[model samples]
Target: MRRVQRVPLDEAARQYLCERQQYARRLLAEDRLRAARFWKDMRETAVFTPVLTALEQMAGPRRRCMYCLDSRGSDVEHFRPKASYPHRMCSWRNLLLCCSDCGRKKGDRFPLDDQGLPLLLDPSADEPWEHLDFDPETGNLTPRFDPTGASSPRGEETVRMLELDQREELALGYQTTYKRLKRELEVALSAGPLDPSALRERLEEADDHGLLPWCLRYGGSTLAPFSTLRQEHPAVWAALSEAV
Candidate 1:
């Protein structure tokens, strides 16, 4: 998953959400809140339409799932399960765009640490690569190993929660995106001195699965053609990484 920059809602949309939150709060106080019914009503509102559009825009042209970044995001997913956290049901920050598969798999299963912090990665709030690692060979996502040789708990939980390692179709999609990026880098390398802006544009276009960040910032640095670029062209690598 990529780090999704949460976009701000316009004044009108923000006001609508604030009103919805007040309604949700009232229902919750009376213990009469039903998450499904509340969301169904909210979904029918004109203001809610803009919220969905904003989420789609955040997912780019494909509008891929926020959790997997694979498959089309067709529905609004509750980051904090609405059933469990009714107060946040209408909260803008608690919503995300997700695919049906991910929605089904993640249904109401919110795990938390001892401190009551969520164990699952929040793409909009956290950098996934910090906890997760990619295997270029197997095309599976796994927990990054820490300096102490223990797998990152958050990464492990996220992978397990999303079944990132077991899904065949997801792995294939990630592999395809990785190869496309690799090929682009190889072609750029063969063409001598790099034009920083041009290379950035090309990589951004090719990065459908959000692997570019992983390549430049994390485990991908040790892998080729990234490794070759880093060693053979330090200045270019620096410039490219910075631009990305």
Candidate 2:
């Protein structure tokens, strides 16, 4: 998953969320809250429409799932399970856009560390590439290895929860995007001295699965096309890296 740049909600939307939170808080305090009912009610409200729209906006034009970035994000997901954290039921920061498959897979399963920190990566709050590693050959996402040769616990949990490494369709999608990105770079390199701005725009257009950040920051830089560019044209690589 890519690091999502969360766009702030408008004053009206913020007010709506605040009111909903207050309502939820009261219900929770009285021990009268039913998580499913509360969420259903929220979805029926007029204010919740704008919240859904805002989430879709954050997911980009295709409305890709925040977790997999493969399927179309069809619903608003609760980062913290609503049944367990009713007080945060309507909190904006607790919401995300997700595909139905991911939503089902992640239902009510929130894992925590020894220190009580969430083991799952919050795309809006954390940089996923830091914890997750991508395999260009298999198009599978696995836990990033640490200096000690162990996988990142958070990444491992996130991948397991979302089944990122096992989904056939997801793997195919990632592979297709990787090939497209590789072809774009190769073509640019063959064309001679690169125009940084033009190259950036072209790559961004071709990066349908948000692989550019992974390519630039992680193991991708050591691979073909990227490695060749970095070695032969340091100036161009620097410019491209900065722009992405």
Candidate 3:
């Protein structure tokens, strides 16, 4: 998963949103129409744009959910439930671009810390790899161990809330992407003295969810072909890692 930069709303769109947020709040008080209109506007502007871009940027070019690092993201997810936090309904940082499968599984459940900060890291606001880790051989996602080596709290919650480790399709998707990345690296290595910039661009273009960052920054360094590159060609590995 990655952090996505939110699109700045134009004056017109911005004003419209402010007005609508109030309108929805009023309607919500009466328990009618607000949900529909909110959904309507959300769909119309397609909240996915900024949300997706943020995910792309933060996640490295491999655009999987920050939580699962699987599934090709297809929806803008709300880190905090919009219904519960109307105050942040139009807040860009509160949104996440995720797959429908993750969205459905995560529906409206906002797990929080004792102090009330969200347990799930905001992909847009934080570097998820800091709180999470990937298991390459098995392709399972889990919390990153801390300096003392215990699983990270945020990572554990993110995994449970999004069901990252349990989703069959998500696991399969990550597995496929991982294999493809490995295969590509092997081909590049065979070519000898690979151009890191050119290869990075090529990989970025090929990535479906703009997931090149994760590959270069995290997945590439830890996994095969990538591991081979790191072991056999430090300069190339450094170049690729630095590019992200």
Candidate 4:
């Protein structure tokens, strides 16, 4: 998963969500809220359309799942499980775009660190590469090892909860995108430097799985083509890195 900037809901949508959340809060306080039923009722109505629309917009043109970045994000997922945190049921900050597979895997299973902070990496809120590492050969995602050789707890939980290392199709998609990114850089390096703007655009177009930051800033930067680019064209490398 990659870090994504959260798109703010427009005034009208924002107000609607606030009002609905207030209503949910009231229900929860009165002990009358049934999490599934309440969300289902709201979900089927025209009032919830804007929330879904904003999530799709946040997911970009392909509307890929915020968790896996592989399949179409067709479901509205709650960052905190609605059953456990009913007060946040309609809160704008709680919703996420999710695919069927991810939704199924993550069904209401929210893990938190000892201090109550979330253990699952929220792509919109966290830089995934800080906690997660990608394996190019195996096409799997694993917890990032720190300088002390300890794996990231959040990454470990995220990968386990979402089955990131076990899914064949997801691995294939990541590998495909990684290969495409490598090819683009290799071709650009061989043909002599292109304008930084043009190189950035080309790389962005090829980065379907949101792997650019990993390729440019994380461990992949130490790899062959990227390291070559960094040495041979410091200006171009710096520009592309800053853009991502």
- Local accuracy of candidate 2 as per-residue lDDT tens digits, 1-244: 8888898898899999899889888888898888898789879888778888889999998899999999999978999999898888889999999999999999999999999999999999998989999998899999999889998999999999999999999999989999998899999999988988888888888887888877865889999888887899889889888766
Model 4 Cα lDDT, one tens digit per residue, 81-173: 999998888888888999999999998899999999999999889999999999999889888999999999999999999999999999999
lDDT of 1 by residue, 169-225 (tens): 999999999999999999999998888789889988999888888898688988999
lDDT of each: 0.89, 0.90, 0.67, 0.90
Model 3 alpha-carbon miss at residue 120, Å: 1.2
The stretch of ten residues in a row with the least summed lDDT in candidate 1 is 235-244
lDDT of 3 at 148: 90
TM-score for predicted model 3 compared with the true structure? 0.77
What is residue 85's positional error in candidate 3, in angstroms?
0.9
What lDDT does model 1 reach?
A: 0.89
Clashing pairs in 1: none
Per-candidate TM equals: 0.97, 0.97, 0.77, 0.97
Q: Lowest summed lDDT over 10 consecutive residues: which window, candidate 4?
A: 189-198
Number of clashes in every candidate structure? 0, 0, 19, 0
Off by over 4 Å in 1: none
Regions more than 4 Å wrong, model 4: none
Model 3 gets an lDDT of 0.67
Instruction: Give the clashing residue pairs of candidate 4, or none.
Output: none
